[model samples]
Target: MARAAGLSRTTVSYVLNGDFRRIPEHTRQRVLAAADSLGYKPSAAARLLRGARSRLVLMVSPGLESARDTIGGDIVTRLGQLLAEADLHLVWQLGLPSVGRAATDLAPAVVLVAPTEEEAAFADLRRRFAVPVLPAFPGLGGFLAASARAQVDHLAGLGHQRLAFVRPAAPAFDLTAEFRQQAVERRASELGLPAPVILRVDDSRESAVAVLRSLRTRTDPVTSPVTAVCAYNDQVAFALLAAADDLGLAVPAEMSVIGVDGDPLGEWTTPTLTSVRSDTAAFVSDLTSQVVALARGETTTVEARLPEQARVVERSSTVGPAR
Candidate 1:
């Protein structure tokens, strides 16, 4: 840039850094034009080392496998736009294994992590970077609990006294599964309903079929046969729907099903699925504000005021059980 602008390196540096009080206006314009022509962009690492704020925000998540089909992708897209408007770049680190390396390389102003991530990882990021490292949103546990309760409430409202909780068999989803299952159990107990029959299911349709059959045939004098299911996610619900179809069970009449995640695929199923959709706009907006504030070094410890409940998207899969 200095050579192209026909100026000293120091002169170019001052102009690029916006220290224009001493330098003439023409010199600053020349340097900027030269930089633009050369496509020269400032390095975030360089800015950070110089004790200046880097225009980088690092976002780390468990994985991107389901991002394209899930709300996770939408949240990331909106978050990037918001950050860009604030002159900050959102850099994603897909998995935890690479977070330390990515943060070191990017020199981000702040780090945001998925709520399901371990606390040790959060601490490591803060200790290594000396920057703010926080969950993408606060009250994640509360949100999960609320969503789970909403599922139970919807089924119970339809006179479903016997409910089953379908959890993912994958170990990767253990944290969220535990939270939602506990919430379902607690809500059922509070409503004077029988405890939810809990079961773990994989992605296989056969697994879902076997699980559903067991729920139907299991002899329990204390509680009635499972009439409704609260699945951990839409995928599980879809599996169960297929199982029900194979068994020739009339959905919402013989067995009602509700799921979390509000997956769009639900609409195309044999019976459209009822789901709890997490309204993430407010949470994303709040997160953007915190990222901007932290990047500007305004303050730390911004309280996350997330939504208390997730909205239920009612569909054909849930209804009053047959008399």
Candidate 2:
């Protein structure tokens, strides 16, 4: 194989074993093609026996149970798929102290998907374990900071003077929700729009409907009825839409609703949901690439930042307020 690729045995071994940080891309491709032609498959067990680090990628998160179908879930699911292609395995764990100890035992390259505030605790994990501790979502603080700014800008651009920032009572995810609320308020003020009304509703159809009903048919402050709402994510937005249906409120015509997480189900809603589409595919690609590189002991640079701009997919749910 080395002679076929016109490379030394060590170079071929490095390429086949995924240790190509210093190898030129062209040379790596030549070695990979040679291996493919020779039908070569590296032995993972052999590497383990030789005391090489385990090909395990541990995904740690706090709300993985309830976060299914959200952006965070998409990241974990997609990352697993990406890592598998690199001959790596993913083991998900809840961000608990016991799991932390288990992680040390496993000695896997770690991807922390926990809350932003908890990041301080993991500061020394990389040094302690001598394994990479890459971030999957760059923490909720970064995501919400970008997502919330996009939401407020989009609504204000659509001439929504009075807006409401709707959040769910998700205790595990409250830190993110609070930061998102702050982002909305800050952006709204910067755009010269009125301060947004912050509303926390239970994650239920009834609670959402009650809030939508009050916003739809209230009279004490007739001058400023909330014409638009920015939900924390698509699931919360779906609840608001269901509530609108129950109250017979005309979506977008009477109230405009926008959400984050470009969930496909958003399109099936009565008035297709307008939403901030997080670049999950791009995010997962960046994250898994870094984890795989780290696991292979390759020094490579990968950005943990979200996309420079948040893309809001316009659908029927968001439009100019009715005159």
The candidate that wins on lDDT is 1
lDDT of 2 at 199: 82
Question: Which parts of model 2 have CA positions greater than 4 angstroms off?
Answer: 1-49, 110-118, 124-130, 217-223
Judging by TM-score against the true structure, name the best candidate. Answer: 1
In model 1, which runs have C-alpha deviations exceeding 4 angstroms? 1-51, 62-69, 115-118, 300-302
Worst 10 residues of 1 by lDDT: 63-72
Candidate 2, 124-238: lDDT as tens digits: 4444455666655674576677888998888888888989999888686576788889999999889988788788788778899889977777564545779999998888899
lDDT of 1 by residue, 1-323 (tens): 78899999989877665454557877777988899999999875565567666678888776443333365677789999999876678987777776667766777878887753355655655676667787875676787798899999999998999999999787777777898999999999999998889999987888999888888788998778889999988888999999999878788788999998899888899899999987888888888888888877676565555566888999999998788
Clashing residue pair totals per candidate (backbone < 3 A): 0, 0
